[model samples]
Target: MNRNPHGEIEEIEEEYNYVDAPAWTVDKVAAPQDQRSLFFTQSFPLIAVCWLILLVIMGLRIHFTSESNAKLTAENQQLEILMHLNSTLLAAHENLGRYCNNLTVQFDLLTQNCTVLESKIKDLTAVNQQLTADVQNLTTRSLQLETQRNNLTKQIQNMETNWNKLNVSRAQWSIDAYCPRENNARLCKACQEGWRLNQSTCYVVHDAVSTSGHKTWEEAREVCRRESSDFVIVHNQEEQYALNYYSWFSTLTTGYWIGLRAEGWRWKWIDGSDLTVSHWTPQLPPAADGQCVMSVQNVGWRSVSCAEKKRWICKKKALYV
Candidate 1:
């Protein structure tokens, strides 16, 4: 055994040397049992504190998860309500669109009807204007017709008055010129009033201005018979010459109606005398049926309708008044 200084006992020994060890090597060495037990005791409190903090964190996570779930549910419900409202609004918009379209169609139809009515009104107005013009023209024509009728009435009245005056003049002349002789006899050589002495025959000429003077061929023959006379007959060229001379004094363009007519295919006198000689104008055309002879001025003779009016000459034997 070896003892160091401070000890009383001393013993002589052999010399021995010691070397220094590294710190890492010394720490690697296992510690004593008592030191290990004391180290565990100190670390126990730190481990307990870490466990408490972990538990607190887990509790906070659970609380936050519950709140997030509740908020998500509420948001989902709200979103569903919004989707339903959008659907309802879309349906209403569609209905309004249809209603507006119907209104547009109705308005278009009304516009067309109004246009047709306007066209009809214009046509009616034009027709009314034409009718008014036609009425005016008819009124003017009626007035013209009325004026013509009045003028014709006045002419008829004037002709009737002239005829009445001529008849009165003839009556006065007959009353003033004829006179009866003694023994109710008149001179045979002297002609009656209004007669001219012509080779033992009394001849009278009807005035053209008198109403009873102008007569058709048939009417002239009847008038001569009423006066106890007959139409002038020309037995020879001398008598025709005398008759032609007498026609020169007439105031008529158409001289007189002779009692000569176309009968059976030849000209004949009304007294059944044969017409052997004719005083026709040069190149006289053939006569037609119902045609009578008329002495025309400067033209000898012409065939005319029996209805034509002309002056005539009558001859009779001289009679006393």
Candidate 2:
């Protein structure tokens, strides 16, 4: 050993530096044990410090790895939750869309039904109006029918009363005209002398053989009254035709007086009854109060002045067996 200028001890190295040097010689040239022990003691501190720094670096790496693994696990959990929520939201959205479609279809159907119902309502309204009008017309017709029935019933009653009165008058006239005054037992004859029997009455058509045979209407009626008879009364078409056959016409002015006369514009019988029928010539007379009806042969009756001299016919009810 030698001391350098820095006052540190330096050891001289043996020169056996061959790769294949003998092991015995190398050992023989080695430093003493005390010297090696002193060298190891100084180097031990440096080795311990290096091992401590390595251990600290390994611990820091383990801590950073664990922290990164935890963060990745948390991120995976968050991703899974977000995916589930997105799936649920998609399903909800699909369901909502289908529901809206269904609602739209139903709304359209309801609108169509409303339109059809409105048309039906309009048709029903028209039918109701027609029915109302028909009901009103039926009511009016029923009222008219009821009034007509009432009027017919009244006319039937009047006709029945008049028929009864006529029957009574006929019986009285028969007794007066056919029974003789001198016979107390009231022996009746069919007709008096010079009187012709028709149906139920006796008639006498006095012929005007010349103008002297004709008499005024009042004079002819007076003569008939003296014989218990009156001027002829035509009651029907048959009676009127019989009177026409019985009458004589010598000229246009020659006619026989009858029991009809004009009271106003209407003709009436001498018994104060209205004329129910008439047979007049084509040239009718002007309506006047004093005009009397005269019968012509093969022609109809004519209206003439009551004072005119014309032949007359008398009539009385015939006696029955």
Candidate 3:
């Protein structure tokens, strides 16, 4: 069957015509009709459904991408802030290290100062100890000196008492004896019994005649020696005056032997004293060898024979009061 341009169906006649033609001549035939099925019309609804699902999936993918981008931007800002904070912390750490170093230096200096102070303290303590020891020694020495002073004071007091007593006894003796005023008061004496007090000496004038016939000069000298005395040696005018006074009072007209004698033409006393002063008579008696000196009443010294009998004066140390 064939369809025309006009919406009508037509049938073809089945006629065979034989033609006389050449050997290559053949009959012309029409192509067979297409019978393929329509695939677009049958799958239209399924394609629409698949397209809707793909649209939904694409929208969901866009939303997820936007969310991930926002999260990444926030994370970047946080990282920048952390970096700045880290830089500030590093700077603070460096400053802290410098301060720590300064503190360490100060501590070392303080330690050195403390050591010096301790050394000074030790020296001061030693000096103080030495001073204390010196003070103690001084105190001990002072005490010893004080004790010695007390003992000396006591001894001096006792000596003063004894001296006072002695002075009193001396004054009483002087009053009783009526010591001569012509002699130096300091040198006067109070003689023993039967002795006459003179200047620092005691004299014994022997008036009694000797039992061995009137004594000679040698015999008088012997008698004075037995009494622990010696013949009087008159050296001055005062002594001569005293003798004269005694002779006048005793009424002695004869001479008395003295200790003077001539030796090698020079006069000397028996006690080795030089005769510097003399009371010789204006007309000295003719001196003879072995002649001694004598003092006569109303006359000065005269040389006499050693064998002549005469009175004698003996002199000795004065007795202590």
**How do these models rank on lDDT, best leading?**
2, 1, 3
Q: Estimate each model's TM-score.
A: 0.40, 0.41, 0.38
lDDT of 3 by residue, 1-321 (tens): 122433222112211222333435344222111111233454456677677777777888777777877777777777778877888888888888898888889889999999998998898899889889989988998898899899889988988897898678766665555455455464444675678877777888887654344478889999999877899877777777766655532223357788888777667789888687777776655445688887776777777788778777888877675
Q: Please name the candidate that would achieve the greatest TM-score relative to the true structure.
A: 2
**CA shift of 143, model 3, Å:** 66
Model 1, total clashes? 0
Q: Each candidate: RMSD to true structure?
A: 16.6, 14.2, 22.5
- For candidate 2, write residues 1-321 as lDDT tens digits: 122444232332323243345767656545544565786686677767777777777787788777778878888888898899899999999999999999999999999999999999999999999999999999999999899999999999998999899789867776765675564576668986578888888889888678898899999999999877899887788788778778865444888899998887778898888887778886656668889988888778888899899988998887577
| Better candidate by TM-score, 2 or 3 | 2
**Ten residues in sequence with the least summed lDDT for candidate 3:** 28-37
Estimate the TM-score for candidate 2: 0.41
lDDT computed for candidate 1: 0.71
lDDT of 1 by residue, 164-260 (tens): 8977976554444444354775333356777887676777877577646688888888988988788877778776865776665443346677768
Residue 284 CA error for candidate 1 (Å)? 4.3
